[model samples]
Target chain A: MAEIMSLSEAVTANVNDGDTVALEGFTHLIPFAAGHEIIRQGRKDLTLVRMTPDVVYDQLIGAGCARKLVFSWGGNPGVGSLHRFRDAVEHDWPSALEIEEHSHAGMAARYVAGASGLPFGVLRGYVGTDLPKHTDTIAAITCPFTGEQLTAVPALRPDVTVIHAQQADRHGNVGLWGIRGVQKEAVMSAQRSIVTVEEIVDELNPRVTVMLPSWVVTAVAEVPSGAHPSYAHGYYERDNAFYQAWEDISRERDSFDAWIDRHIRNTRDFSEHLALVREEGVVMA
Target chain B: MTATLDPPSTKATTDEIMTVVAARELKDGVVCFVGIGLPSTAANLARHMHAPNAVLIYESGTIGAKPTRPPLSIGDGELADTADCVVSVPEIFSYWLQAGRVDVGFLGAAQLDRYGNINTTVVGDYDHPKVRLPGAGGAPEIAASAKQTFLLLRQTPRAFVEQLDFRTSVGNAEGGSSRSSLGMTGAGPAVVITDIGVLRPDPQTGEFVLTALHPGRTVDEAVAATGWPLRVSDDLTVTGPPTAEEISALRALTGA
Candidate 1:
């Protein structure tokens, strides 16, 4: 069964140094609070995994918390490049970060295989692309039934997976809707999991599209607006302006460090960080 | 200079003309797997103007998304709220895309070659790149699985390179029947829509041939912009200018 804990407590109890951690949310319901908590806790040498490593992963990579990143895409969404990620890969500003890249199909297949308790996932991908030359995880496999050749990627089994959701019942059953991404698969593929929810409800709403029974998750934390900047379907809208502003704020090393220090490190929690952002006029009131 | 031969009534920008031309490629009800930037704009424009029933699928797992405005990101909540249904990322790639349900894969490229192979990975070496681009998200599989693929890119000497820094998605491979030998299911990159004109692959040789030039864009200008020795079709034709309805609908959808 899962225990209801504080975000800080959940990170302290679950995440450790040198762990393969996945904070999965495509572009919506990203676990920004959990990522912040992990950054604040100063965990190091983590192999961060996500299909799209959005701003949260950018922050983590910039803060020098990650040693490796396993992702398909790393960008600022509608915005241009993720400067911090670029810095890490190009210059290795704080540390030497290694990357193992794959296409979205390959990454998704790896997760599916992990969730299904299989050794690897097969797909018709990377036939003429240069991706297979760079990554060792992708290989050619011949189908047993047919003579067709396919690509096989090893299953991704992360040490810990974190996600943000809309609600969690007292018994720690998590429920989330809107763009469901790979949160369920990530949770199932990991040895331990953390879910930060907007609220702890008496009963999960019937309309919830994805319901995670308590047994699968390790801990649950109630952190309202946990997916700020990113959006929870019914709770709030995506702060696109912030994402645009991040382009400038994260462009330089000094600016990114100062922003992180003032907003994430010095603050007590996500709410405090959010308040600082609002007070500083970084985000609209 | 070909300035004397240019038309005066052409008021539409190159991007607008390109988008309108690309939108015209989508049939009324085809399922289009859309990339984020230019392709998304074109697909949404098609929905708003002609192809109302054209299903737009984003790799973010929003299937049949009918957004009022073009989404900034693929997984914007607007896409989900307006989608017929939403699935997980794995399912979207596996059951929907790799399963061959998508008819047209519309994509944008950072760099492209004559064979239609894309290079969105890097601009230099893989281990040590001069410029690093966002790596392949879904282009490889989408290019390999969708019934046909459409690439949208602004043509330039830099982008239309003779040799790519990295090949992220395969169109026709080396030329001719190379894509077939690789066992890829889809008929790779049917047409490449650019700001200057449309380039379609030759039926006999898989090399992309400059089939049509947009109004006011000279052939010399197109030739000058391409890095490779671009081949022009034997019977080259001029692209029809964007109609008032196309410009108005595109502007309304983009709010530009």
Candidate 2:
């Protein structure tokens, strides 16, 4: 069982530079409040692992919190283009770590392979394609038996994994409920785990804890509205205006730091990020 | 009652094979965690067919996704446009899957073993693994949480094998209820769909025993294509041939 900690404390204590931390959330839901806490703490040299993020990741990287990024796709392109990500991509900062672009399955499978202590997670999607170019961050090789060339995705063992849930207790035994076991891979790969949740519970019995309880989840914190506009999937509703605003800001590289300064760096609470959303109003869940 | 060996009624060109396999997994009212390629195709086909209500969720957070066709990968715009909602990857896992809401998770593997141990890695050892493979997306959770997992592969010696270089996702390790004791929180697989028909784990040994063969297929063909020696049930059943309605509808759907 982990000790009860505050949001601010967990963020500052666990996250470190050059740590390959798996940030929770996908494009918008469950906007990894823990990751936000990390950004606020000004943690740097972080490399994120994921297929995509709405703007949270872009904000983190733009704020100079992230030094390396890996995944199949990083930006929203023209529509909700990840502007800060693009700037970082096109020399926003000098020499960021490898920006890999492998298939989504391939990326997650590697992480799973690592967590399971397996050799490789076979993938058929990228077979005989240029997708191999992007996956070279791990590299590729030929099969000794058939001489068939295959992408070699090395094991992914994250130093820390920060996740969010619908509910959890001090020991970090979490229950995400339904349609949200997305962080299972990160949980599998991490050396240490921290679960941030909407509310704290008294007892997370084995009968109710969604994923297994035995994993060494180091700590827990109460985040009530952790996934405000970004929702916790079934628990809350989508914060479209926030996503829309994030998409718009991610369009131009001109105001990268200014955007973060006005939205994040200048704020102490959540409303400030929404104030820039242009909707004039965003109700926190 | 239908005698086998219906000749090669179009073995399915590679792309077509991809589409056929994809369409085979379509269903209605099922919740799916979608990825690109075979999984995407199958999920989309499910939506297009009777399973219009079938919801597709991507690791990127797009949910109730109804992509018109397969996205190049996870980032394709099709996923966004067709989705009923979108959230973070973590939410997709924590809330939807780990929470136990999703039903079927469509997966494509590089190689598979008798126990459903997948090798997405190489052909050799780990340290200097012979061929490094792509990593897992959300498949592990899909395998663990979905009511049951649906795997779609064209099938060949290289794919259907004796041993997977690596075990990317856990299927029926050591078979039976042993996984439960090992703390596997997710539901074990109920079935495995393949080009040859379908395979189910034996009741006692957990070794794969062939349950059915595609229309006209013989045991010899399936075993010949398998990389390792295969198994069969004493009372093997013949798999139904793709109905004309199925073939035509499938072809038109896939556009191959």
Candidate 3:
């Protein structure tokens, strides 16, 4: 059963150096607080896995916490390039970083295979693309029944998976709705899991579309507005302006370092970080 | 640039024409797997104007999303709020997309070859790229699995290349039946709508040939913009200018 713990405690207890960690969210309900906690804790050599490595991954990559990234897409969503990610890949500013890339279908299949306790997942993908040339994890497999060719990707079994959700009942059952991306599969695919929720409630809302029965999770933390800059569907709207501002803030190495130092490292927690960003007029009130 | 000989009163920009022309390709009630940017705008415009029953699927797992405004990102709350239902990422790719439920996969590209293969991964060497692009997200599979694909990108010598730095998605390999030989479920890119004109794969060669030029655009301009030795259809025609309704609806949807 999941033990209710503080975000710091959860990070300390679960995440370790050189671990293959996955913080999964498509674009909504990203575990920004948890990512920040990992950064604050100064974990190193993590093999970060996410489908879309959004700005949070950018931050982790920039902070030199990640030695490698396993993802499908790495961008700032509607905004342009993730400058920090670009920097790390192109110049290796703080340190050299390695990347193992795949298409969204391949990554998703790998997660599903991991969750299903399968050795690999098969799909009709990467036929004429050069992705297979670059990624060793992708290979051709023939169907036993049809003798037809298909692509097989190995299961993505992570050491830990972290996600942010709307609520977790006192029993530690996590419930979330609205654009539920791969969080369930990610949790199931990991040896350990952390869920940071907006609030801990007496009972989970019945309307919640996806639920984790607490047994699958290792720990839960209540960190309201945990998906800030991202969104929580019902609780708040996406701070698109912050995403846009990130383009400028993350463009330069010094500016990004200063921002991270002031906001994430120095702040007591996610709430404090959110408050400081808002107070400094970095985000809307 | 040559001035339009018969300028319409509505005065639609080339981008508007490109979007309008692309939107017209979507048949009523078709399921479209949409990429962000121009493809999303065109798909949404089609939903609002002609194909009201059209299904717009984003990679974020929002199926049948009917957003009032064009979403800034695939996972914007508006998409989820207005979706028929939301599934997990794995299910979206497997059960919906790879299952062949999607009829049209609309996409955008950073670079493309004459065979319609895309390059959104990198602009230079894979190890040391001059410009690293957002790598293949869902395009490779969408191009391989969606019954047909529609590509949208501005035409430029740099983009319409003879050789891609990296082929992120397959259209028609080597301009022949090679794509089919690979056992792909879907016919690769059917149409490539650009700022200058519309290009369709030749029935015989599978090479994308200039089939129609938008109003005021000339064959010379299209050829100049392409890096390869461009081919023009023998019976090439001019595309009609965007109607007043199309211009207005597109503007309203984009809020531009």
Candidate 4:
């Protein structure tokens, strides 16, 4: 059975230093609240994983929480480069960061393989590609049935997997919809999982794309607007303005630190963060 | 730059021409594994134009995403609401993409070689890159699995290189028999639609050669812009300017 806890409690209880963690979301339902809580707790030397690491990951990297990032793509969406990520790589302002990059397909397969309790995932990829040159995890294996050579990457079994969803029932069965990335697989692949939901209801509407039964989930935290900036399917719209604003906020070291200090470090929870954003008159939507 | 003897009927940007040229290549009802940005614009334009039934597959697991506007990124939630089906990411790659269900795979590149192999990984040294571009997303699998692939990029000496800094996606591997010997079933990079012209691989050599030029561009200019000793078609054809209908539909889709 899964326990219902506060976001801080969930992060404090679940996430630890030097753990391999995956905060999975495609472009929507990103676990920003959970990431903020992890930052608030100041967990260091963590390995962070995601398909696309945007503003949230940049913030975490800037705050000196992550020692490594395993991702396919890292950018600021329609805006531009992630300055903090660039700084960490180029100048090592906060710390020297390591990266293990993979394609979206590769990461997807690895997650699936991990969920299935397999040792590695296979795909018809990385042939004549430079990804194999940089990443040691990728290797070639011939298929047993067809004898065709295929690329293989080891299954990603994270220590803790965090995801944000639309809702969860009283029984701790979480439901999520819209641009469903590898949330389900990530949750199942990790040894421990934390799901931050917008609300807890008696009966979760059956329109969800995928659902996780109570037994597989470790903890469910009710953090409304958990996926702000990144939208929840039914709860809110994507804050394009914030995404646009983040370019400036994340560009310079001083501004980035100041913004994180004002918004995340100063706030206790997501609600307080939203209040700060509102008070600062930074339009969200 | 030599001025064209006959200008295009309507005012259109180079990016617009590139999109139209790429859009025309997509056939009706064909499933395209589309990358976000330029590919998405072209695919959506195709859906709004001649290929009304064309399907757009995004890596975010949205199959047949019919967005009202061009999505900002692959993970845009609007893609899901407007899509016909949304599956898990693993299912999207394993079942749909690697299963060889995709018909046309559209991609853009930071760098490309004469053989149409792409390099989105790095610009300089692999360990210490001069410019670190976004690494391969799904391009490697799309290049290997799709029945055919279409490359959309702004042609430049820097991008269209003799040799890539890193090959992130294979076009024809090295040359003829290379892809086949490697057991890659898909015909890699059938068409490369650039800002100035269209290039297709030589049947025997698998080298991308300029087959057609857009209305305002010249063959000599195209050759000059390419880093390799680009070959021109013996009987080069000029691609017709974007039709008003195509332009109107593109404008409607993009709202630009």
* Candidate closest to the true structure, highest lDDT: 3
Q: Model 1 chain A, poorest ten-residue lDDT window?
A: A276-285
Model 4 segments more than 4 A misplaced: B1-9
Instruction: State the lDDT of candidate 1 residue by residue for B48-142, as single tens digits.
Output: 87899999999989999999989999999999989999999889988998888999999998899999999988888998888778899999999
Ranking, DockQ, top scorer first? 3, 1, 4, 2
* Most DockQ-accurate candidate: 3
**Every model's Cα RMSD, please?**
3.3, 13.5, 2.9, 3.3
What are the lDDT scores of the predictions, listed in order?
0.92, 0.62, 0.93, 0.89
Candidate 2 falls in which docking quality class? incorrect
* lDDT for each residue of candidate 3 in A1-285, tens digit (9 for 90 to 100): 999999999999999999999998889999999999999999999999999998999999999999999989889998999998988888887888899999999999999999999999999898889998999999999899999899999999999999999999998999999999999999999999999999999998887999999999999999999998899988999999999999999999999999999999999899999889888996773
Sort the predicted structures by lDDT, highest score first.
3, 1, 4, 2
Which 10-residue window in model 3 chain A sums to the lowest lDDT? Answer: A276-285
Each prediction's interface RMSD? 0.7, 11.2, 0.7, 1.3
* Candidate 1 chain B lDDT trough over 10 residues, lowest sum: B1-10
Residue B38 error for model 2, in Å?
18
* Between candidates 2 and 4, the TM-score winner: 4
Candidate 4 DockQ category? medium
- What's the lDDT for candidate 4? 0.89
Please write out the lDDT profile of model 2 over residues A116-234, one tens digit for every residue.
Answer: 88876543234323235335644556778986544566666778877777777655667764334346677777887777777777775443425636356777777766765555634
